[model samples]
Target: MTGYERYLPILLLVGSNIFMTFAWYGHLKYRSAPILTVIVVSWGIAFFEYILMVPANRIGATVYSAPQLKGMQEVITLLVFAGFSTWYLDQPLKWNHWAGFALIIVAAWLIFLE
Candidate 1:
């Protein structure tokens, strides 16, 4: 597969995560939905998450070892969560947020190391 194809999973992973963040946290903004509805809605959105995640792992399998795929997924999740929290949720990013994300970014860089 091409390099882009290999990274397609990563892209979908981000998209899924963004949707997931919305499904879960967006409720704070939209409280009309009952708790049960929220849970069901999140689950519904999460279904697409597996769709992307499975393909991501499969395609990444050829280019990356299992450990790498898992590690990449973790890092991508955190980064996506950060952006989704700040932008979509309209949450102000505090110092703690930066510090936490910085650490995660450092960890991501370390994982990229052979």
Candidate 2:
């Protein structure tokens, strides 16, 4: 596959993870929904998550090593959740969070190190 084709799966993975995060955490804002109901809703959303995520891994495996795929996924997941938590949850992005995120960046760099 070409460069764009290879990246398509990664983009889809990102979108799926964003949807999953919202489905899981966004329910916290809804007081009317029962715990069971929220869980069920999240489960429903998570089905689509797997649909996209599995394909991403398969496609990524063709071009990237296992550790590289994990490193990239972890980095993107952290970045996405950081923004989601800060903007949607009305939570502050503390120094600790930034530090932790920086560590993850280091981990990714190490994973790809020559």
Q: Which is the leading candidate under TM-score?
A: 2
Question: Which residue pairs in candidate 2 have backbone atoms (N, alpha carbon, C) closer than 3 angstroms, thus clashing?
Answer: none
Pick the lDDT winner.
2
What local distance difference test score does each model get? Answer: 0.77, 0.85
Task: Give the alpha carbon lDDT tens digit for every residue of 1-114 in model 1.
Answer: 696767787887777677766666777877786889888888888788777778878877878877777777778777777787778777878898789977877876777788
- For 49-93, candidate 2 gives per-residue lDDT tens digits of 888888888888887888988888888888888889988988868
Clashing pairs in 1: none
Q: How many backbone clashes does candidate 1 have?
A: 0
